[model samples]
Target: MTIRVVAKNYVKPEKVQDFLGLCKSLVEVSLKDEGCIDYGLYQELENSGVLTFLEEWKDEKSLDQHLNSSHFKEIFPLLSEYLEKETEVNVYRKTL
Candidate 1:
């Protein structure tokens, strides 16, 4: 079954633009991964420095692979520095 993930990143104020730049590359690379159905990146306009990702993957395995993928590893350290708080990720599956 497809898994849905909502990942939130609250970036530090001064690093907002830098974070966006980092995300652009991360998004570009993530989209090319196997079993990645959808990967959408967006910034919360009203709340600066807040970014969110809505993703859909083929399965838990696909999602797990993505978590460990090189793209993730490459960007995580850079992304971490800009975060104001721990990144929050919510995972789900449709029951309907």
Candidate 2:
């Protein structure tokens, strides 16, 4: 089954640009990983500092691999410094 992941991040207003730069690196590398179906980053128009990461993977193993990827391990902790609050990450499977 395909896995979908949505991660919502509230970036500190002063760190939005820094956050974006890091996200760019993260997304760029993540897209090349095996089993990555899709990986995209989105920002809220109404709230520029609010960002979201939408990802799709081939299966549970793929998602787990991604979570354990070098980019994820290195970048996610750095991303936390720019966040105003803890990120909200949710995983789902298509039922329809």
Task: List the candidates' TM-scores in order.
Answer: 0.92, 0.96
By summed lDDT, the worst window of 10 consecutive residues in model 2 runs over 62-71
lDDT of 1 at 87: 91
| Residue range 1-96, candidate 2, lDDT tens digits | 899999999999999999999999999999998899999999999999889999999998998998899999999999999998999999999988
For model 1, residues 1-96, the per-residue Cα lDDT tens digits are: 899999999989999888888889888888888899999887787997789999999999999999999889888778888998999999999999
Best by TM-score: 2
Q: In model 1, which residue pairs have backbone atoms overlapping below 3 Å?
A: none
Model 2 residue 36 distance off true place after TM-score fit, in angstroms = 0.4
The ten-residue window of minimal lDDT in model 1 covers 40-49
Model 1 scores what on Cα lDDT?
Answer: 0.90
**Each candidate's root-mean-square deviation in Å?**
1.1, 0.8
What clash count does candidate 2 reach? 0
Clashes of 1: 0
